[model samples]
Target: MHGPSPRRPPMRAGSLRDGMTSRRDRMNHVVLTGDRPTGPLHLGHYFGSLANRVRLQDTYEMYVLIADYQVITDRDLPGSIQRNITELLLDYLAVGIDPAKVIVFQHSAIPELNQLLLPFLSLVSVAELSRNPTVKDEIAHSSQQAVSGLMYTYPVHQAADILFCKGTLVPVGRDQLPHVEVTRLVARRFNERYGEVFPLPEAMMGEQPLLKGLDGGKMSKSRGNAIALSATEDETAALIRKARTDSERLITFDETNRPEVANLLTLAGLCLGRAPRDIADEIGYGGAAALKRLVTEAVNEFLRPIRKRRAEHTEGDVRRILAEGNERARERAVITLGEVRDAMGF
Candidate 1:
């Protein structure tokens, strides 16, 4: 016989502060996660995770971060860095991310938040930093002479980002579980060593299967496998046009054998909310050219309204939205920073 269904544990005392809050407190539990914003949101973004962020906004207190400083950890160019912050925000607004629901703020704005970083560094050892899989993977990829201290201790920095907000839940993809684990470790050490000032944020992990790029490899902008969310219809159409496919005239979605075709089918599936195989079968009967054409049309059509919405926006509007987001973020940051100061006996 099946056992009783698992129950959600009671919300912590901090979450109970909602009893004092207005607006039904749908935000009893806060969720925090962000892209490094090294580049714009891309097609793989839509298929895998953007829709979930849109939906989760109503369910959790959300903070969508422009990790402007973190971007410099990997990419050190100044001009590219400044341009990306604006472009990343534009991408966020284009894809129906409401600033009212989800705060869209930059890391640089909350300058005081960096103080948490120093204490966090002391909690984790140099050996622990060297062993972090992400740092190792990044170092492996780059034959650069020296891995910067920021990049090496990036996990602790991530912990600062999460704990600073006292975030209770963080929605992250599975590959990032290790990072979340590191944050939890920091929380445990902090509470044990200092005080229970920050919540051990739980990983509300994203179950969305990792979306691969058109080349069937990891979806990344640098790889040229990306379809940028802000790209024009003509631009998106051209990218899809160049999307690699199999030699055969006939088409069937076999992700293992025909990953390129399957990737396209998956994109179509995400838009129409159907299984990739099902969409593949419906369109495959007309042969490869037809399948390609159908996907191109559907994707462009789907992106059309979003791009228009983006176009209608102005820099002033974006600045205003970010200003609102910044204020909301700063309000929370003030409380947490105050608590941190008290904890450290300042």
Candidate 2:
């Protein structure tokens, strides 16, 4: 004689070595993951990596890096880079990324990562870098324009990021497997040449690692198709209100054919913790309008507390957090660099 269960609320949901501990937990394997601070983090980022980071941080010695250096590879906006760095930090905190649990540090602050980059550069061949699928896809996406040498060699830099922190687990999308492969190659070459200073990093992909963009493309800020995590309720509603859907009056999840509607369904399902097909079935013959409205409401509900928490943090708070992270990152960098220099007889 019980009534139907009420709908549940949406689930609210790094760094690096500046917060390193002197404990003997170094024997425990560590995870290193990060994002380029090119723009605000979006829902795509949430499902793609942020969600996984939140879960993994509790179990692993997590190092979440704000890849400030990597941002300069494609663009030359120094001012935007600085501002995005802070924004990125705020986004991390807003999404329930506990700094105390994960050492969230900036990539550039650790000079050891850069030093490792140089030695790794010698290990990877230009042809090898060119053969990377991500590099080719990115370069092609950048309008086939002339890219900086750094842009071309970024996979090697990524390897430096992983090995510099001795990261063993790198959570990434399936498409990023090549980057992790190169990291493994670089680690093996270095270990074979000098000594086993780094562990071979492996790619960890979640069951659903990617979330499509509003425009039925890859969710990306550069493409202007992403819904940022810090977007206001109104902004989120507007974005979903504008999301593309098929002309079919009936709501259904057919990702291969009805990709756009399916994408919205996926977003709603993720926000509400249900399957996309379940949502599609619930909507039934209500058509795209009803589907959009439900998705908008679910997305806004999810973002409400996150936006509120984000508003509470000021620029000064972000700076203090980064500074502390930088210090901790430097501590580990110093130790790693000294060992590397010794091994290389530098």
Candidate 3:
């Protein structure tokens, strides 16, 4: 029903290669990062990526995408997606991700960006897609008995998310490295088959890439082990109270044997900006209760300003930010799509 829109005359071969090189050089500083709007972000998100995003915005040209379409990749569409998007924006703002400095946009709003998936999907084989470890893990853990086609080619869709923005720096945890590798492969293959119309994005890992859940498993909103960024002080305390800590009275940061205890220390240390072992030493004979009390206090204190900022925002403010960001993202997507179309001689 739709076709490649009219674009400028294709660049000459030599000039096109030169243009690609120039664009790649400029794109080296562009950082693409985002989260799925399935639920409110939690402490794991804070230490894992949100904190790093706040720090990176000042140094790089950052684009924070709300991956709305990815919500249904492993499950049915959630009715809370609309509210979740607003909450995600609030979380981003509360954590000092200045919308003025960062382009925060929703995925479903940009048709041109999704349009990239068709071309990108063709560059990779089904076998290769099946071989992606992340995809395999997701499928293994998924509730659905049968995986959707969208879930299968998720890596390629991610490639579109990265390449559509000419994003060369992608912030991801170690587990997510494979998805970024797929993006790089698509970029390399596309360039080899057509022309260099994309920049191979590099994955940027944060200092603390993974944070454990309260239950000593992966901290996830769906798993009910994470404390949301918007959680009240009382709510945070209640959650931490239930956090799985061992019966060993003496507090020590031994991650191997005493992982649960170490996790509590890690959470407190992250909030206090100190070493977990130091925090453990400070709570020497006090044990889990004392450690829990300290973590609750430290976490609540650290989140006070962020909660205040979150409370200050209204739904109207969120809509305005999304509008401005969507406009900017669409502008970039249009230009990138046109270049891709021209390069493919469409």
Tens digit of per-residue lDDT, candidate 1, span 210-292: 66777667777766788888887788778777777877766788878888888888777665556778877787557667776
Q: Residues 182-257, candidate 2, lDDT per residue (tens digit)? A: 9889888988998878777656555662688999988888888889998987888888888989788889899889
For lDDT, the strongest prediction is 3
Better of 2 and 3 by lDDT: 3
Candidate 3 global TM-score: 0.89
Candidate 2: 10-residue stretch with minimal lDDT? 1-10
Worst 10 residues of 3 by lDDT: 1-10
RMSD of each: 7.3, 6.2, 9.1
Residue 293 alpha-carbon offset, candidate 2, angstroms: 0.7
C-alpha lDDT (0 to 100) for residue 9 of candidate 2: 21
My TM-score estimates for the predictions, one after another, are 0.84, 0.89, 0.89
Model 2 lDDT at residue 232: 84
Please state the error at residue 99 of candidate 2 in Å: 1.7
Model 1 regions more than 4 Å off: 1-27, 140-145, 285-287
lDDT of 3 by residue, 153-257 (tens): 899998898888898777766678789889989999999999878877777655652688999987888789998989999999999999999888899999999
Total clashing pairs for each candidate = 0, 13, 0
